[model samples]
Target: MAIRTTLDKDLDRLKDLLIEMVNLSKTAVEKSVQSLAHQNIEMAEQNIEEDQKINDIEEKINNLIIQLIAQQQPVASDLRTIIAGLKISNDIERIGDLAVNIAKSVIHIGAGPLIKPIVDIPRMADMALDMLNNVIKAYIEKDIELAITTAKADDEVDALYGKIIKELLELVPSKPDSFNQISQLSFVARNLERIADHTTNMSEHIIFMVKGKNVDLNA
Candidate 1:
């Protein structure tokens, strides 16, 4: 009983750390879009610098998972949770890295007026953020349905990505002078689309953790 209690406490701590990681990554995504939209170089630079916090949290989670396995030798279900934690943390960290990528694009574009008004790119960011928010909730609740729903959200992001690319390509003929900014804007959209993909990966991990079955949610 004492051993079980200790393992439970450790699992709770792992969950808390995962939540912290999610929140930080989510903020990074939000700020990346905001900086691009408003041309806020300070926010973009700060978002790039703070990505380390998300990376640090993932490292902490990795250490804890290793300690739990070594010291406790958890049961199959607990082991599943721990393994899922490791994978999910990686996905979240990737999401943060993609956010940093978007921020970098913002920096590259500088304070110049965007070649076109920012519209679909922010919409893509919003959808990606929504997916991230829901997937974490699905993980906490162990709700497979929610996971499925969250994974489906990625399709909308992909569609928006396609639209943005098509529209940007169309602009290249007339807006020849603004090629650099146009390319950076497309890169930003691609980063947000990748963020949605990572969130879908997180949902897959959550389903595996709960069901002990490997299913592809990305399909």
Candidate 2:
């Protein structure tokens, strides 16, 4: 009974850290896109610097999971919970890295005015952020249905990314002077698309935690 109590406390800590990691990643992504849209170099640099915080949280979650497994010797559902948490933390960390990528692209584009007004990239960022938020909520609530729904939203983000690429390609021939901005914007869109992909991976982890079965929500 004492061991079970201690394990429960550790698991709770893990959940708290995971949620913190998610929030930080979300903030990084939001700021990344905002910086790109407004050519805010300071905001972009801030998100890039703060990415370390997300990495720190991921490390803490990993350490806690290792402790739980080694000390508690959890089995069945408890073991599944630990494993899922481990996988989800990895996904969240990658999400943070992708957000940093977008921020870096913003910096590369510099503070110069974009040749075209930003639109679809921010829209894609919004969808990805929403999917990320809902995925974490689904994990907290242990709602597999919500997880599935969140994963499905990735499709819309992908569609938007595709459209952005098409539009950018169309402008390439006519807008020779805008080459650098166009290139960086493409990179930003790709990073946002990848963020949605990582969020979908987290949704899969949540479903595994709840069902003890490998289900592909991304499909």
Candidate 3:
């Protein structure tokens, strides 16, 4: 059957907008991490400034969503799709903000001495990025199994986060002077972990979009 309703088209547009937002967010995150790892202050500043672009995209998506709701009078899955778009856009915007937070942390740390090797934190970041990328793919392709697999990948991120925390704790006790710096690194890990959680949330939203079923990740 052909998609005959204006509502369907609007919903499709909403999904497209979300996919753009996800791509922008992914670029922002990758750049933010690269800036931090390389101690490129200029690149960090650029990432921080680019957050406004993400905000603008989010605002546009929101306006489109409101327009669809007021004009389309959609039912069933169309309604669910609109709701999912709103939720997913929110998640993506927060992901952008988290990237900005990491960038800011990089500036705060400055050209300081090495706080370990940053291996674990970057590894956690890679996993989080992979989760975000795959979840967005699942949304675009309507692949439920891929979404579930992305959700399952969150476990690895959580475990890496725990390990980072443990290692930081040990470092702090031994190197009392570096406690504050280590704590900041821990915050970076926490931000990345939260990003993974948001990606998982996106996966749940994808499940809702495809199956009309709500999934509780916490349960």
Task: Give the TM-score of each candidate.
Answer: 0.98, 0.98, 0.95
For residues 1-219, write the lDDT of model 3, one tens digit per residue. Answer: 243566667777888788888888988888878877888889989999999988998999999988987877677888888888899999999999999998888888787787788788888888999999899889889899999999899999999999989989988778998877787788888989999999999999989988999998644
Off by over 4 Å in 2: none
User: lDDT tens string, model 2, 111-206?
Assistant: 777878898888898999999989999999999999999999998998999999999989899998888888888898898999999999998998
Model 2 poorest 10 in a row by lDDT: 111-120
Sort order, lDDT high to low: 1, 2, 3
Candidate 3 clash pair list? none
TM-score of model 1 (CA atoms): 0.98
Assess candidate 3 and give its TM-score to the true structure. Answer: 0.95
Q: Among all windows of ten consecutive residues in candidate 3, which has the lowest summed lDDT? A: 1-10
What C-alpha lDDT does candidate 1 achieve relative to the native structure? 0.93
Output the better candidate (2/3) by lDDT: 2
Best by lDDT: 1
- Between candidates 1 and 2, the one scoring higher on TM-score is 1
Worst 10 residues of 1 by lDDT: 112-121
Task: Compute the lDDT of residue 197 as modeled in candidate 3.
Answer: 94
Sorted on TM-score, highest at the top, how do the candidates line up? 1, 2, 3
